[model samples]
Target: MGGPDSLTKDTAHDVASHRIASVEGENGGGKEDAKDNALQALSTFLRDDMEACNREIVARMQSPVPLIPQLGAHLVAAGGKRLRPLLTLAAARLCGYEPSPERQRHVGLAACVEFIHTATLLHDDVVDESTLRRGLASANAVFGNKASVLVGDFLFARSFQLMTADGSLKVMAILSAASATIAEGEVLQMATQNDLSTPIERYLEVIHGKTAALFAAACRVGAVVAGRPEAEEAALEAYGTNLGMAFQLVDDALDYAADQQVLGKTVGDDMREGKITLPVLAAYQAGNEEDRAFWLRVIETGEQHDEDLPHALDLIARTGAIQTTLERAQSYARAAMQALDIFPESEIRQLLMDAASYTVSRVN
Candidate 1:
């Protein structure tokens, strides 16, 4: 896998540590506490059900081939917050779906959402040639790409099986469309990857495909399982779509603005990979001829050097690229919160709203 230059492991580690210290000092208390509290509230609300979802994940990952289970488990056990699955469960409960042997099927459906997300991550690491995931070596980095890809396929297959087992054609249709959309989004991102001229519209399209589509699908499934009316279904989907957009925008900005530890990845990984995220697009479009030339050389031509990162960061900061990106994220977060208004007031509704704000707070 001959990719463009990337930071050495040691360099990224040191840079991340320094960024964490700086963020800790600058961000003192407020939003950080809110973010943690919101996530904790959601997690506490769904703890028992999430445990059941985990058990379902483990049961479904079984294959006669031990390597398949091992690789799948490795990725699954990695430190993701399981936000998508949580959305499914919470959305269902918010719709007043009562717990029963029948209602418990939501757990399996939530597990299916996790499998889809995990499969995508596995394939994404292969596509990106990524070495680290969730602060540890990626499965592809340790087990080899062939194993990762095949195991990812297995997971995708497993998810479809789980979807079918739930016996809801509505659920099946929503998740299947999302799966295809996610693939299309990955390919779209590939097409736009190194092109500095990639427009903001195209960038948003890519993220909607890659990130938000599944989020919408996940939440929509919850309402479906609850036998909620189509209006409620649309509301949850809207909530998820906006939340997903906000989440990705924050993520794109954090890749440039966050400390390595806080971000759980290298600061300039997107730039190094020539991925044209919002911040890069913002700075490039805002710059004069000289800045455009710099972007052309580094992003388009992949001629980045050590000094180029600082220069890029300087350009982004001076152009208020991160600030503008985060502002867009906040707008989406607000929209996400607004989407929940049609639902009755409940602790779950407030937590979901808080969850939207928490998604963008990393960049705040």
Candidate 2:
């Protein structure tokens, strides 16, 4: 890898090209900086390694079958934060791994992490019937669902190939377990869908499997690759897990938010799909008798009409569900920050801290 000077310049350009619009005069720019630094700062510090990882991702996504690479490239071009692989790379660096042949191995592993995430996204769009992803047409929307599913299987196979090349039982075990958890979580979410009776603990279990499992695995693999001690590995896993919990909780709340631009999709999509998120659960749990009847008619019976969304929003507001959800997210972010106590203070650690804050900052 190049020195810090070259890395800083390259990564800043990458950040500027992909960053969200900065919030003007918001919290004296503290909030804006926190959001920007979520990915930008980490990319700056890991520029060279990330570039290598990006190259591997692109190269591996190719196939002679035109449909496979075509859909894969379409998703690659669609802008996402690419945060999963970034976490993998950043964790490696935070644990004192530097640019070397051994460190270079992490590049492919990071790409493997990205492949796993992308594969899940493809499958999720088909399952959720989601039309949009990152403000662009989703793979399942553009490609047929059958094609998307097959291509997703291809990506998963590719990820497993990368894992095998690493030849570390620990890495293999972690990634494989994460993959199983993600599948299990999706099934559990589907099973719980539209049932307002779903408990908060069950909801937490679903997200932990679907979202936080991979986040923990991503960070753990970084430590495993670096041959870090078990204590440091566990800390990174804790940090990633809590950060992921915060991220998903905010995402669930945003489904019913009024601001569509920030979400890049229609508000109340979860409600429309009859997905039982935290805010919905909160409102339903606290509702009056009439409110309960209305919710049962809409959610359980799937009898929702166009006017139902506004009433749902009203109920959510009366219950202060969004605020309660945000508070829960903040608690997780604090826990994620505490997980970093074992590491000595560094710019990388600070960026990670800010990233956790940024996860919950979407509500602002």
Candidate 3:
């Protein structure tokens, strides 16, 4: 939960400390403020489209089973930034797609994207045994794991219904493939959990399948609906993939470095769960024998004590793992920005680029 300054003192990694400071300072008021401004700008730009998407989301989530709607509304009302759905809507608009009364494919598809994301959150909470989400009690905690899992299944079914109604096999193919890849990623994560020896390449595979696939699918669907060229579709997909990577890397760093109040969930939850992230890998790779033994006891053997988290944080900070993680995230953010260069200059394009910058800048 400590900031860079709190974590950096008395450490020999001066260069990494300075790099962290410089990156945070470059965002002006703060990374959190910068991210807030970026999200607000995107939301305002896509207000009408988002409203339609919300309506579609509500309508599709309804069912005769009262518990379904109740559970779905609880999660929806928790009010995440809706970044996935927003990506779909924004990417569509950026490709010159407009919604009409008779044809609002983007809106429905945006809602569909949200359904998939929300379903994953429900399932993930159950799997991670998570109690909090978006600074509120998670659905699994409130509704029981059984209900949470069932509701997640319901949402997945609903997403497919929306996709089928869109009547585009290409759209269906992209989303369905993403859904499968997400499942595979979760399985892969489970396989690698509590194992300190998991390689960086394997970790990248996990994140790409779990997070980036949907991001890429969401953006590519936009180009598909607009009947854009394959080149443009590939470009947007690349942008989304890189942005998702940056976003997840920042999230991992924040688990070790962010204020708990700002982070919404418990700090070090990943460490507590013995999940091997980039920070852990970086720190372990740089640590000596004693440090390696410590990681083995806590992470591999699942034997943690009251002071273990602080020690882990110290190790991560002293090794400059958080800074290293953030720097890698910055590279992905830059790649995401470059992917958009093929598109001509426009307000939407700029907003998309800002969104990519915000992916790395966000502290929460």
Candidate 4:
């Protein structure tokens, strides 16, 4: 495996641009279509397994209470990329595990990963007072915060049931610990909200727990199910962790820069909500005294006006915060690609590499 230094910025950009162009050529579409081309490719490659996993997800989401499934189905229909579960399935396959009647644990576990993610989205939307999710009305908006919270709890319970059904103490321990860490991450984010003085280390810790923990657990369980060696498990965990960090960093950048139509959510939601993400942090760190005062007014004091978002964007742009954040994401994506060096060359492995590239390319 190469070190992070092995993949320079130019190299990462060239590789990702080439991969994006390849997908665009194949699909006869533009760069817009290329954003999710890796996910589409992985979905096509794992169509059968993903179908089975979807079935398991639908089945487990059911409840006697009508609203449980209704709210769950609404979220499912909104069509998130399901990246974590895909990681689980892809990792299992990369480890040479095939689903069978007696050995179908991966499928259920994949569904379990989705359940956990969905539950988090529900709770997060409620906490953030978000009205939109994936360009659709948020569950909390449509179903009410109480209903969304209760249904999220229901999904968490269902996820646990699937974990118990898997009958692997190791799997249960991995996922359960991730769940706890996710909660702590959310709380930590809350603690840091509206506080511009939050350190970079604390911000990294929050994202590691909030986003990367489940990603690591999801990939690790795939190796566990395949009974692969501990080294392989650790490799996949590293890949997922770095991939997740890259993903979140790009997401934060997009919050300020992306087109709402393309981003599938309102731009500047983080800024409006006083969340101090990497872009904000970097901009604040680099800004002059007046710039610091601006961030203090809009973010720290939460006195944002309708025109404040544009000024914030200008500040971030002038300080090159968005570019810096994306570069940081590229480094993580490079590390993620290097992590997969332990695996032998194969179609699945190449697609996994492309997926890491896609994580950084998303901001392009």
Candidate 5:
């Protein structure tokens, strides 16, 4: 289990085939090449906002109080790729938000998205009793749970205030609904913790409600706020939903497949926490009776330990659970690309497509 991740003989064949397809995809010309090139150029647009917004984030979080300095500084400094905020900017630009023509409304909106996301993370760590985030002690670990929760609330209120400045009822409605939905998802996840009997449908529902909804809503807010056409707005929302699902799927995969160093969390951590993810679903469907018994005794009994990792990985492999789960992730990514047909050929649009592909297929 501590060795390099290697597929069993049967799955190795699938990997071989997948490798060929990947090589072809990577080297493909015309559309694919252009997509890659466009995505490369996106750094120019996202880099400034990513850095400036991050700096401003620290500045904005500063309060005259003592606790605020320690806690807020830790949170604002935590390394995140800031994809949600980046998505907002991309949508704004696509909708034709010109810095000169109409002012950079995108900056405020993107910041709002990030604020809400960070607030949620702060609270989620407390709920999960998580010790680590982004390969470091979680805010709750450093600041203590009470401070984390209260500070999270402060951020939520601040995000609400920022959203109001956007001056769009539509944007406000979308984000407000998203925030409420996320809260519901937290409750749903809590209700189902360590529930090995949780059906695949229920698992999908929880992920959709908890994770994908916000991505969809956030992208929708961005596109709609920038005054994109209805069809393009819908397309972007679909893009976000698909991308979010793919991202979560990969996250779930890495929880089982990746090293603690690469993943910023321990492998099998999800299983230890009794979180029933896609691989678990695949294992349940494909496992033998004894394998099922093993899962039930460990996961259902809420007694899974670090030692249970091998059995879990073996069972998943025996059942080809990992393979099936990865396939599902790819399916979602492909569906996302289909949604992009609404947009005309543009560097940004194609780059979005490439980025979506990369999100689902990441190794860690």
Candidate 6:
């Protein structure tokens, strides 16, 4: 919209690097050194790319629909970590799209990822009937659910329009499949809501569909757009999936473990809404009869009070649900790092790998 100075490539890279940590080799001397090298290189490139992405988002989102501009601004200005677009950039780099003219094109794709993500938030707020988002009034809350839903649909259409403009049939395929998966995931979640009989396996399945699917798509699209080899494409896909899974696990855990201020959302929101997540599944699996009944009552009958929070948390904590969820997240993060092996040893690869580590453990 404006000049790159508004976003400032220098600023965007700094934000992207925080999402991950490097894997250490057993030797301690070689792996960390290599990872540091990669991190430095990747950090330099990401700042410029993220800045460009931010600028494009600002300019490209101009719309005829009044609600699109208003609601889109609220979500974009919320200042998220921009993880989806960052992954696209990382995958492109891994796929051999370097610092050249083609790189700028990659920035557009990155913006697409962020736009699609933001659009999802608009829709999710309506579906969840959420009053808040990104530490502010949710679009559905301030703009009304009808407007929010309509605007969300508009954004979705706009995202597809952008993809078609890019003229990549493959890109369209990747995005289309991801969109379908996301819708199916939402439906799966809807089916499970308020249903205490839901199993742990089903919960993870829903998480993959709703959350990780797009993450995988972001990375896959980047690699494909950049004309990377199949191995590299697979690598980016795996990386996105693992990173996505880790994020959801941590997100679920945060609902129980984090401060409302730090989380930028209300405490126990999922529990209050009866959306059973991984931690809840783990807790239920590990709980006793009495503990199980307590959770069942609070979740199904909406009988919860603040006083029940501690007991519920204790039950979750005592059963090692928090640790269990964290461990699951870590497993995915590890898988993400392993997928990066196809790419030759590079500073950027290390940063991407490290990013996987950081995503699961980031407090904020």
lDDT of all predictions: 0.84, 0.81, 0.85, 0.86, 0.72, 0.76
> How well does each candidate superpose onto the true structure, as a TM-score?
0.89, 0.89, 0.90, 0.90, 0.85, 0.86
Residue 48 in model 1: lDDT:
68
TM for candidate 4 is: 0.90
In terms of lDDT, which candidate is stronger, 1 or 4?
Answer: 4
Q: Which run of 10 residues does model 1 get worst, by summed lDDT?
A: 1-10
Question: Please, what are the lDDT tens digits per residue for candidate 2 over residues 250-309?
Answer: 998888774876677678878878888899888888889999998888888889888999
Query: What is the per-residue lDDT of model 4 for residues 299-340, given as tens digits with 9 covering 90 to 100?
Result: 999998999999999999999999999999999999999999
Q: How close is each model in CA RMSD to the real structure?
A: 7.5, 7.3, 11.0, 10.8, 10.8, 7.0
**What C-alpha lDDT, on a 0 to 100 scale, does residue 112 get in candidate 4?**
95
lDDT of 5 by residue, 1-364 (tens): 1111233433433343443334333433445344434433353445554444454455456555545545664553345556787787776666665655345567777777888888899898887789888787787877689988988888888778878887888889888888898888778877887776788778777877778778787677767766778887888889888877877888888887777887876678778777889898788778778888878877778766666889888888788787777788888889878888877787667667777788765655
lDDT value for model 3: 0.85
Worst 10 residues of 5 by lDDT: 1-10
Order of models, best lDDT first: 4, 3, 1, 2, 6, 5
Model 6: pairs clashing at backbone N, Cα or C within 3 Å: 9-47, 9-48, 13-47, 20-354, 20-355, 21-354, 21-355, 22-354, 38-347
lDDT of 6 by residue, 188-237 (tens): 99899877789878988999998999999999988887887777788889
Give candidate 2 regions above 4 Å deviation: 1-36, 101-103
Clashes of 3: 0
What is the C-alpha lDDT profile of model 1 across 220-310, one tens digit per residue? 9999988999999999999999999999999999888887876677789999999999999999999999999999999999998999998
lDDT of 3 by residue, 1-364 (tens): 1121232222313332333334333333433454557866777677778666766776676776766766765665466777898899989988998767899999999999999999999999999999899888898877789989998999999999999999999999999999999999999999999998999989989999889999999999999999899999999999999998888889899999999888999999999999989999999999999999999999999999999999999999999999999999999999999999989999899989999988888879
In candidate 1 the C-alpha lDDT for residue 76 amounts to 51
Alpha carbon deviation, residue 111, candidate 5 (Å)? 1.0
